[model samples]
Target: MGVHGTVAAGFEGVREEFSAFLTDEEHAPGAQLVVHQGGERVVDLWSEGVGGESLLGVFSSTKGAAYLVTALLVQDGFLDLDRTVASYWPDFAAEGKGGVTLRELLAHRAGVIGLDAGFTAEELADDRAIAARLAGQRPFWQPGRFFGYHAFVIGALVGEVVFRATGRTLQECYEERIRAPYGLDLWLGLPQSQEPRFLSTLPMLPTPEQAAEIEAAAASPYSLGGIAFNEHAPGNGELYDFPNSRAVRAGGQASAGGLGSARGLAGMYAAAAFGLNGRAPLLKPDTAAEFARIHSEGTDLVGGMPKAFGLGFQSYGAHFPVLGAGAFGHSGASGSLALADPRQGFAYAYTRRRYAFPGGAAPENTRLLGAVVRALT
Candidate 1:
């Protein structure tokens, strides 16, 4: 019934909002929330079902880290945004994808969302395997002509470029340059020592009405959305089960396999936009701006809904009105949301053990973010 952790004096409203939302929930959500104002921790709260140190799978929010790594490479001049992906990974040019640029691929414009034949569960857990399979697959649409949410494969596409350019995996780069240096809890490839802290993600418990609506809106496995999520695969399990598998957690599929708590999620963004733990900020202003600027807006070809995307992160400004322009971050399928708002001088993160109904960013984020902004003002 009570919330855990501390908030700065002025941020009591955020605690109140978090508690209010929990009180109304029929099920325990096992949630964690963390916020950083520049380099200072302002709010750190967790629900009864999850502790401040507990780690949960942060689905697509993993993409933010992947994107950040890519941004760093670009900032260092190791990678070029405008260069054709084929220029770096020659095999990527196969199947009429010779012209897909790194910029377009990061923007979800490459159209090679997933392999037509589908990936094995084992392959889905490995980014290199996923990349190899996708290399020969034809684009779902003409490259750069339209945009779709490359829900499951964007990381592999970008990671491939990173590997080709630097001779290291994205996870390796993230660990050496980002995670280990900051001692962040977020893990792209979680080590065995950290295994004890992980709390396996729970599936969504939708209300009867929500369940009925989902059933009504269900698309065929052959549909674009289905393929993007690899649901069309012959033996694919439910998307929620991906993180439960040890292989998936061990390999850290760049797309959605990150494991972390709210602290790690929030801290990673803080390190990117504002220096953390006395370290300098990871991203330069120009690099962050280029990655955060809206590159694709309007209907997503895969999701069949209005969406907005920056290089590899979601355009937070479009989805959360409280977030100012250029705010960038991403949400996970399990209701985890994390982002950095350089304009507002804060980085925020929220993670849940249980999936929320109508997934993506979870409904509670709006009120919670508004409360945080009000407290900041």
Candidate 2:
């Protein structure tokens, strides 16, 4: 490929290793992976195939953006985690969910996993309609019974909370308060003009030979692309590819769909690791602490593993070590991952077109990041 940027301060050897990782043809399509140490840009690297301006789909990594939205509302004193969802949106209590707390929803403990089968893609386009549908819908499991990853519903649930607390939708509020202020290129509902720039996510439908080849590889939900799996099948599902997808996209749903550039994503977390404008914190210290707190522990409904989750982001463990306990970020469908490690004062975002294991190509990426972190530390 052509010339990519270099690492800045504390991350010297990291950039060199990242450069070697980028050269892997299997890891290509392209990506931008950046790491910040002590609130300073240390490793800033972007490969050529993944241009700086290209907005590749970051899959579920969008959840990190969603977490930022909820955290901001909490910071502004508009939304309280301990408060019930019904406090902001009255209809949220229509069903047995009247008692579901914002924190429960944030931590993916909300029993409302999927919407009613009657729910349609058209309804997802209208925030009001979807919110109403969700408010009156019954829980997939008993509220607080246990945590199951609410894949698609997590976005609408969190976004609606932000909306009820603030007059603006998650997308609008995020842009004005977060992305715009930081000059980040991340977006939830990408506009039509920019849609062309978005690299549509390709399902990791392994070829017959590949599928059989990897049958014994592992049985991870993410490995099977479970949560990472897209249900764009013909049904009364949400309109994922609608021309007006931007409206729903504006909601900043963590799961279904969101868009942005790798660098832009790196920068957002970069701002989190560092401060935005001097003294202006993206999340209050307490809130940031909570952002990485694990609220639930059980077999993730989607990932089908013993996983833990904070308010919105996933942490490091058997599944991902690149994201340590102190780190908070999310992985998207395909092979996109983003996170912030306060312990190391580091943030990294990587995006690529290739969709490999749903459990993520983390093992491989971890090898790459381990080298990076070793250098930074």
Residue-wise C-alpha lDDT for candidate 2, range 265-365, written one tens digit per residue: 77788776567545355766677778788788768765667877888877654356654665778876557777777766677777776565543434456
Runs of candidate 2 exceeding 4 Å displacement: 1-3, 9-12, 19-25, 124-128, 192-196, 203-210, 213-254, 277-279, 317-324, 359-362
**Shift of residue 285 alpha carbon in model 2, Å:** 1.9
Cα error, candidate 2, residue 211 (Å): 1.0
List lDDT for all candidates, in order.
Answer: 0.92, 0.67
Relative to the true structure, candidate 2 reaches a TM of 0.84
TM-score of every model versus the real structure: 0.99, 0.84
- Residue-level error in angstroms, candidate 1, position 33: 0.3
Global local distance difference test of model 1: 0.92
Candidate 1 residues 101-193, lDDT tens each? Answer: 999999999999888889999899999999999999999999999999999999998999999999999999999999899888899988899
